[model samples]
Target chain A: MNSVAQTFSTAALQRNPAWAQLLGLCPLLAVSSTLINAIGLALASTFVVIGSNVCISALRRIIPDAARLPCFVLIIATFTTMTTLVLEAFAYTLYIKIALFVQIIVTNCMILGRAEVFASKQNITATFFDALGTACGFTLALVSLGVVREILAYGTLLAGAHTLFGPTANNWTIQLMDQGLLPLAAYAPGAFLVAGLLFACVRTLRSFKKIPPPKSQSLIQD
Target chain B: MADLALLLIGALLVNNFVLAQFLGLCPFMGITKGYDTALATGIATTFVLSFSALCAHLLYHGILAPLGLEYLRIILFIVVIAGVVQLVKYYLQATSPVLHQLLGIYLPLITSNCAVLGVALLAINANLNTLETLIFSLGASGGFTGVMVLFGAIREVIDHDDVPAAFRGTPLALVTAGLMSLAFMGFQGLAG
Candidate 1:
């Protein structure tokens, strides 16, 4: 029980998939221009990561070492496909906007990294908690970026909530300003700049107190 | 001919895979510390991307679409890409052992690069024919290589500059990339 709790905290804070590990930046940076889109992608990725982690952990004993990567990728791809179908069915508008990124989640090093580094060796219970923590950490990163970018780009929060939440959410959007303060924040270049500044902020906060070295170096690698 | 040239230039500059479209960022940030290694990875990636795009186009239109197995594309495309990377590895091993050694880990790492898959998927999504798919992949990979080399050069210079502790490595690199991306955005008018 204690070990499980520790694994959850470590994955969530010390080794966040997006901010620290930098495993899944493709989707992280691409779809974060709007809060709703970010939330949608976050939910889909969480489902895939946790689903793949649990499945991989349960089948670890049988998967061959030489073929483990293909196996892990296959599992991740299956879950990603399921996610695609689910989104297309329930939130067709949102699905079309992020279809490419959603499909490429299979190649996301974050999911594959967890499978190779933690899931393949740990028991199912521990793997579940680890996946939960990583998913939460990833969600936090995505939502924060989403909030920042959305406010800067559109001057609105949850601008298109109706796409994800159906007709009822048509009014969920909160207009923060008459016009976006920085229209550049909606463009491709803005993503890199905002992400760079965010990283610097995180570093500044961490510098005040010493933290242990990351348990693994660069989880973005396959 | 003019349309093809436009597509090429558009993919190369206006819609660059890394700077503009945000694909293949893992390698963009990871393997870009040195110019030589970055160029090698870019070349290998270009080779894999063009070939895989060709293969994916054929497989999708020839097999999957005909059989109504389009939903299986994500899985199939990834598997095919992994196989293509392996084939590239062996071909390089037999032909150019020195180059193979230079790109040791990054060669296999290409299997997971989203840009390769992104090109393939984007080709199908845009309904490009075989020739167009090939051209687009080449252009996209070309853009990828160019930006990588440029970023590599920038990082080399950045290493010598005085930098604060909080923004030394990735943060600093990202800011440089943002500036580069801003520069690339200038080409937007050239394409359209």
Candidate 2:
């Protein structure tokens, strides 16, 4: 949002896709139990988003106007298959941990949303940046949840570093608490609590800076 | 009867769609801004999600798996959902203009909803027979409706309350959902 270019606001970027925009929450709380899992999911999702957006943007003109939505799904499925194949082949360890959610990425509105909104209209370069920005926003949210879950659940940061960063990061974990305390914080309700706290931290920072929060807009009427 | 009852209660309360399973969140946050629309959207989504789950299950297990086209399930499911949404739209246009108006853009958005796919995936994961999958999908959708309506109603009440500044919107909803999740957790041991 700070660039000389004004593509999209960071606030717009960082609005909770799960908690705020309500776009992709299934994996947000579910796969976030560990940093490595969350990071792997984020990478796979980002790859799909970017690949789909770019293809949709490039093909917008040549595609029959009527088949736009169907074409977009085909594009997304192709990219998803590509990402899925790579995950299944090389990163089977992380892949197994996240396979279902990886496939679920095909269902994420965030990907189809850009396909419908930006990529369907804009050029590839702009769509590329847009996906990167949105994925960064999503990654920011994922990593926050990951940090909270890893700390509360496992008493350490990067507790399963080998799964994500490979053996090189086996030394990166930092244990901050003793074992077997605050068991509830490691569970589902805890995911909700940590997400709430993270939202508060962002809101507090936004308020102190005096930025206006985006008010709810009703696009459809009953 | 007992197993069916357990599945119904487990989905409807213990594993309430919004708070615990985290399904259909877009509608949960969007429709909750008002009471009536939330109720309408919830009902509409329940109809679509339940049906989509059924179709996805039939296609996934009955056709795709048999042909070893499981890799194509996502696209196939989306295709089925899109077709279903259009059919529903046409049917609504023919019969209930008021309800059609109420559904608005959300009808097509249903195809993109993760809940439908989540239900589909859960159906395939459990590898349930047709009867069980239908019951589970319907139960999950029904539970989704119940939770969306409840959350929307509670959120309407919370919106008027004097919440702290930092806890104003999504944060507060999430916290309320967390508490609701805790409440739902109470239903855990009841089913088994």
Q: How well does chain B match by TM-score in each candidate?
A: 0.98, 0.92
Q: Relative to the unseen true structure, what is the C-alpha lDDT of residue B112 in candidate 1, on a scale of 0 to 100? A: 88
Docking class of 1: medium
- In Å, residue A123's CA in model 1 sits off its true spot by 1.3
lDDT of each: 0.91, 0.76
Q: Quick one: best TM-score, which candidate? A: 1
- For candidate 2, the share of real interface contacts preserved is 0.59
- Give the per-residue lDDT digits (tens) of candidate 1, residues B90-173: 998999898888776788889889999999999999999999999999999999999999998889889778989888988998
Q: Return the clash pairs for model 1, or none.
A: none
Model 1 lDDT, full chain set: 0.91
Clashes of each: 0, 0
Model 1 interface DockQ: 0.70
- Model 1 CA lDDT for position A12: 89
Q: What is the interface RMSD of each candidate, in Å?
A: 2.0, 2.6
